[model samples]
Every structure is written in structure tokens, then in C-alpha cells.
Target: MSYPTSSSPRMWWTCTYAPGAQPFRGLIVPVLEEWSKSNVSDAFPFLAPIDHLLGSRRRISINLAKLFNFFDQEIVQRRLARTGSGSGSEKNNDVLDILLERHAMSKLTRQEIITFLTDMFIAASDTSTVTVQWAMAQLLRHPEKM
Candidate 1:
């Protein structure tokens, strides 16, 4: 998938699934931006190790690509469902959810499950890292107060 462009207002929605796009909504953007202010120049040194691991963009663009790929896979799964005889009660879950639920259904192969897990881990890490940093800052600032 290509990088998001300003041409489309809904580009972020296309890149990020609706549930995942919650943070990009107006309310969350301001909060994220406010939280991001703590990440000015000085934060770089502290984030150096992670920067080396995930790179400067934090692989956000890459994850957006993967998310797009996930959409394609969903289409494939839909076709499979249509062709295969399945009841209407068939479960509906996202890729990561399906990967985890596979222990009961065993639909995906081990390797496929692992790759799905990796993708989810990377996606979650991207969001959680920022939250962790903010919490850490609050902790450090309010050591005695906390």
C-alpha cells in the first residue's frame, strides 16, 4: 500500500480499520498531539534504541501497508466462505482475532498464525509504546505525589 495522501479526507479510514482509527478522530488527535509534545527533540535520545529497532517512522507506514494487505485477505476469506458451505452463524472476527481463536477452529496453519500474531504485535506495539512513554513521564514527575 502507498503512503496516505491529503487528496482524500477518508484516506486514514481506508488505511486504518474503523476501530483502529479511533485515535485519529478529532478528540483523540488533540490528546495524541498533546501527549506527543513530550516527545520533542530530547525524547529522541531516550527512544534511540526503539528507533533503531522500528526505524524513525516507527514503521507506521509499513503497518498501514500491512493493514491494507489484511483488507485484501479479508476479501479472499469472504470468497472462500461463499464457495465453501458454511452456516450463517459463522464467526466474524478480524485477522488477529481469528488467529487467536484458531486454537478451537484450527483453520489457519501454524506459520500463518505466527505471522498474524507478529503483525498484531507490531501494530499494538506502535500504539502502546506512546502510551507507555506518557505514563512513564507522569510517574517520573509525580514520584512523591504518586
Candidate 2:
């Protein structure tokens, strides 16, 4: 149920990028931890209007933007390397590879590719962690039933 162990495979599968322990522990994990914190706006609908006033939304946005930019840069570098290699025949079974292939066919744009990578990281990483935590809590609470 550890975040890094649980999340790393999903991230790798999606982006073909493994953040490794340090970046996962220091960067991705902290963002998820902060995001898990409760917001007052969640309890009071009227407070939603002032959610940004507390700066939590702003901070989360900035952090997420940084994460997205990191992925974007990595994707760009991969594309550059692929072109620079001068052998376009090579292919790997990764999401980035698939996206690039589609891009070559004019099926997707650069911005779309970046957005897909960002969404994949966020959705896969967070959902896997939450699902594992929920399953563990349920099993612990109903050990006899299991």
C-alpha cells in the first residue's frame, strides 16, 4: 500500500517514465498528500467562491502545472531524440510512442499529447493509491468476513 510502490507501475505504464524513488517520494508523493487535505469549501458550498482566497487552490494549481511541465519536457525530449536518431523504424510499446505515432498521422496535436500524458499521470497514480487504501481499510474493518 505504499504510495511509491503502488503508483510507480501505473505511471510507468502510462508515460513510459519511471520517476524512481527520490522524485516519487519527494515530488509526486507530496503533491498527492497535499491534495488529500480537506478544504473548507467542500463542506460549505458558499465558501467555494472564496476557495482561491485561501491560496490552497492557487498552490495546488502551481504544483500541478509544474508536474505537467515536467512531463511535457520529457515528452519533447523523447520526440527530439527519436528524430535525432535518424532511424524512424524503431518502435516501443509505450503510450508516448503510441501518441507520437498518432501525431505522425496528424491525428493529434502537441498540446493534446501533453494533456493526455498529464491526465494519465494524475488519473492513474491517484486512483491506484486511493483504491489500495480503501481496500486495505475495508479488509481491516471486516477481517472476519474476509
Candidate 3:
């Protein structure tokens, strides 16, 4: 999770967050939560027409756009750093760097890079590993609850 950075004085760096920083209270969590739920269209495919009226589908689209935009900005920032315009370098300092390296050679498309970043972000999120940690913390807080 820690990426070595040439930026002196800072021993290491993180791709998504600072140590002990809870950043999941953001658009990513909401969009993911919405996606995890059962949609009306999932139950009845023909009712897709009513999706517009229901507005749930539109909400997901909007959130997804925002999510993609977030990743796009991250990519641009990392690309700048990788090119020496920002604090990063062309070296494989992080996953983004590796992806961008391949990207520069046309080995990967922009969409593919973004998708990989999205997966990495999601995997780094609390929706998986942190779930167990959180449950243990809660159990310790209220021993009777366990």
C-alpha cells in the first residue's frame, strides 16, 4: 500500500490515502453501495422503461460520471507527475505509474487504465478487508454485542 517516493523527508506514500485517514466517506462509497443493492430492473428486465420514471438508474449514471471524472483527474495528476511536471517520476513508483508506463506505449487504453485504477481503489477500500476489522472493533466496544 505504501509507494516509495523520491520526495525526500517523506519515507513512503500511499496511493489513495494517508495513514489512519478514513476517506471512504466519499462518492465512491455511495456509488458502490447503490450498485450493491437490488435494482428494480434486475427483477424485471422489461421494466427498464420505467427506470426513467423511477429515477434510480439516472442516479447511478450521474454518480458513475462523477466517479469516472474523479479517476480522470487522478490520472491527469499522476501523468503530470510522471512527466516531471508534478512531484512524481517516470519510475514505477506506484500502480498508476506502471499503468501509465504501459499506457504511454499504447499497450493499454485510457479506459483500461481507468478500469484498473477503479478496481485498485475498490480493493483498497473498507468494503472488503476493513469489514472484518470494523466488526472486531465494534465487538470490543460492546462486549455484549458479540
Best by TM-score: 2
Q: Scored by CA lDDT, what does every candidate get?
A: 0.45, 0.68, 0.63
Off by over 4 Å in 3: 1-13, 16-25, 85-92, 123-146
Cα RMSD (Å) per model? 15.8, 3.6, 8.1
lDDT of 1: 0.45
Instruction: Rank candidates, TM-score, best first.
Output: 2, 3, 1
Best-to-worst ranking by lDDT: 2, 3, 1
Cα lDDT tens digits for candidate 2, 1-146: 23543455343434345555344344455567667878888899788867778877887878777777766776677777677879865555576788888989999997888778666655666787788889999999999968
Q: Mark the 10 consecutive residues where model 3 has the least summed lDDT.
A: 3-12
- As for lDDT, the candidate ahead, 1 or 3, is 3
Model 3 clashes, total count: 0
TM-score of candidate 1 relative to the true fold: 0.32
